[model samples]
Target chain A: MILAPQALLSAQQQIQRDLHSCLDYFDLPHPLKDAVHHAVMLGGKRVRPALVYASAQLDGDVMSAAARRAAVAVELIHCYSLTHDDLPCMDNDELRRGQPTCHVAYGEATALLAGDILQSMAFEVLGSRMFDTADLPNPAIALRQMQLLATASSKMVCGQVLDLQAEGQSIDQSHLENIHRNKTGALIQAAIMLGATTVLPVAHPSFTHLRIFGQSLGLAFQVQDDILDITADTEVLGKTAGKDIQVQKSTYPALLGLDAAQVYAQQLHDQALEALQQVTGNTQPLQDVTQFLLHRQS
Target chain B: MILAPQALLSAQQQIQRDLHSCLDYFDLPHPLKDAVHHAVMLGGKRVRPALVYASAQLDGDVMSAAARRAAVAVELIHCYSLTHDDLPCMDNDELRRGQPTCHVAYGEATALLAGDILQSMAFEVLGSRMFDTADLPNPAIALRQMQLLATASSKMVCGQVLDLQAEGQSIDQSHLENIHRNKTGALIQAAIMLGATTVLPVAHPSFTHLRIFGQSLGLAFQVQDDILDITADTEVLGKTAGKDIQVQKSTYPALLGLDAAQVYAQQLHDQALEALQQVTGNTQPLQDVTQFLLHRQS
Candidate 1:
């Protein structure tokens, strides 16, 4: 059920082009411009953008400019978060994507500004006239997309706050869920919702079904990540491995025991697929994505 | 011609109320909620919100709910910038508005998250349907307003980056102006533009006039701030005084002599007033506000 590697590569390339085009809007100074370019082109797996594309495909419509912009915007937010989270005051990470982190290459101040500018650029892309048609889609849809991105971003930061607060403390299951659901799950759900919203009305039943599917898949995605942190090697992971355990951060395997954690991931993956079954289209891409999340090695 | 104290007070109260109401939308945890509240409620001059109100009034219409929301959004962004700028890795300031900085009150991690959430809330305030009217204004205008905010924010951050880089370096007058224009001028201009967009079309000639006015006033405002850092005392400024010099940072007065800087501020203030001459309606409030900026202390 794995997706064709070519499909993922094409999506990444499309997103990369859209992201690069964002820089053309601003005549940024040379150093800031270079850092912004480096931040976006760090070459991580374009999973969020891929989700946007796969979700858009669910309605049998070709990817429109709106969908492409949303994909790029979500990816920009993801990249911004990674850049900031790796700052010296925060995670203090040195390596990202098998390369030196943004602050390590550009000074801390430039890296901070780069993250801030990247975040602003995300909204600019969503709000601006990125489309080529004479008649644009409903403006309310664009506003709603911005709202979704902002809300998810707020939740993601709040989750990070909670994670930082719980660093040395012994947290329970509900606490762990709160952290992951906000930290990682909110934006994942936002990616799917943003994509679905491009073609589906906010009140559509398909929207609800997709929300549930995204929620389950997002949680599954994080659980699998937690599993990989302990089981995967650094060379395969492409970043530091076992970071969670090293930092004494709680993870699914630590909280639920390794055997039960695997079982839980499988259960969430099945639930995600079940939610997609209610939709009346070819959901094979979504199914393949869910399967991919469940089995991704890095 | 100074703005009536009561008028400024009323606008400040209105903006404060709208900002507080934003918290009602989210049931945050106690600590984070308190920090966010503290960040917003650390009352300052509310000059940005006043500019928003004054600009909206230039069209001879009562302020709409949209205008109120835009005013609050600008203020929230301003607050978020101050919160982040005071972080240990950034300015590392210990006081603001005569208060212990957010990072000082809460931990650095919490303060960082608080700033991030406050920024998200700004967009939420702008994009959400907070109005009582069933018929909303054109969605394109709202999108344009958001774009202005995001662009201004990016420029402001870039300015901060430049400022950080320029510290301890002997910079020229043009470089100093560049830092202030992006760091402080962009958002101030954005506030005026946000208010004007609520009442004026994007293509309206008035928008151009207001942009010039805002740019002039924003730069003048920063020059005055630099002058006050040397001329004013800590108790009157309500923040640390002379910290710019203490940090060995470049300022307008440092690049240009203090007397020439004062003359430059007066010139910019005159330019701001001249831009208002082309505006159609009774621009009394704007005129009074600009006069206040040119002459006020503390």
Candidate 2:
């Protein structure tokens, strides 16, 4: 369940490098650009990017350029969603992953714009010169990956809307699952799928199984997030704990209770592993990732 | 300048078919899907798509599919922006293209989800089976086209954010241009570029000239929009007129006065025609489209 030392270090380095490139090309108007720069500097696990890089390398050494481009693209989508979700109109949270939220740090309007710019920049990155360097074999496959990213992004945004709406409502299991699926699961699935798509021509056989792995892992990831929201301290979790309950936002733990949520997460982990089993070659990195999803405390 | 009888009719029919296919595949939650359908059905010129169809036809007649796809995709991005812009945290408007706004017709949350879903669906349409039909010679080129679409969509979203920020602020000419370029011109450019890419394999010595024609026209088109915002009435324009002034939004008219805005638009229009002059054969459609852009009341 733990991140192996080498895997963890490599993921972190990839995240840092990709994040740097993400902010490198944008030409935002004054303070807005600076604000976004600050947000990126504010630490995040870069777990999504890590999953991409690690999974891409699981079979053997893959091209860094291809893996990194996909990693950055997924993370950009992830980061942009975080920027919007923290907006006053949505989550209205003052803090995120430890630091003040984008809106909190630089007014709601700028934060909203920051997120918008980031989202646009992500696609630009995917479509830009860097992608060309990846020698993506097929421009069409890259475009398809971009489409997948967009779909995942929309799901996340929709999830935010639904989560906000569910705030005072007594939602059932189906509704909660919908919220998480859109919010957390979609991108996670996208991150994995994007990585697979990068090598889709070569790794064509593994696509479906990889997608199923992503979906299962994504569900497990959200359940873990819910558990952390309640069980982890603010310092360990970085953001305010129990904020989900305070805002009356729906969460797996909130609906299923801690014990049941844990069971559900375990089930997803099992399913994710099962899906992983279908793919040939080394799966240790994916296994590590799934374990981390189920067992991470924060 | 008017849509040549045959050209105009075919463009309309093509767009209608594309929209039908787009909606057929999308699965929005019941009420939200209905709301989007309503918003989309409420009319606008379908100007963006028409431009693609016109530009594509200039090269050859084999772009029916590309024109339709680009048309639907641009419309979706436009609709999503309108929905989000109407949210309480943003422009807080109540009407659009002549009907009650998406948020006004649907609850704000559902409207938001509808918009989000529509954006995702746009990318999906580009990547979906509809576009993938018959399997082209180069799927990679098709992917590149989709990537171009995503890039444009991202720019539009960023431009929306910029527009939101520019309200109640004093912006210079360049800033206003930047906003419009990203907001409107980016997608317009994409529409034209995509049409060319689609037809390139079928029609050699392609429509690179058509794309240049489009970029110039697209910029001219936005400048015209600025002029219309001040000169046109709410009844004619559909949305609230002079709300640009009301909200202190940055516009060419706002920055340079009405006379100057008109001059800018006309100059851009003339320049657009100059660009079109490079194309040797059948400039009639191109010329007509250029003049229509400047002279149109709405």
- Predicted chain A of candidate 1: TM-score: 0.95
TM-score of each: 0.95, 0.89
Candidate 2 lDDT over B243-262, as tens digits, reads 87787777787777888878
Candidate 2: CAPRI quality band: acceptable
Error of 2 at B47 (Å): 1.1
lDDT of 2 at A95: 76
RMSD of each: 2.3, 3.2
Residue runs of model 2 more than 4 Å from their true location after superposition: A1-4, A131-137, A161-175, A200-203, B1-6, B131-133, B136-138, B157-175, B201-208, B253-260, B280-283
Clashing pairs in 2: A140-B140, A140-B143
The sequence of per-residue lDDT tens digits that candidate 1 reaches over residues B1-72 is 334466677888888887777777676765788889889898988889989988888778598878888888
Model 1 segments more than 4 A misplaced: A1-4, A131-138, B1-4, B131-138
Candidate 1 Cα deviation (angstroms), residue B125: 1.2
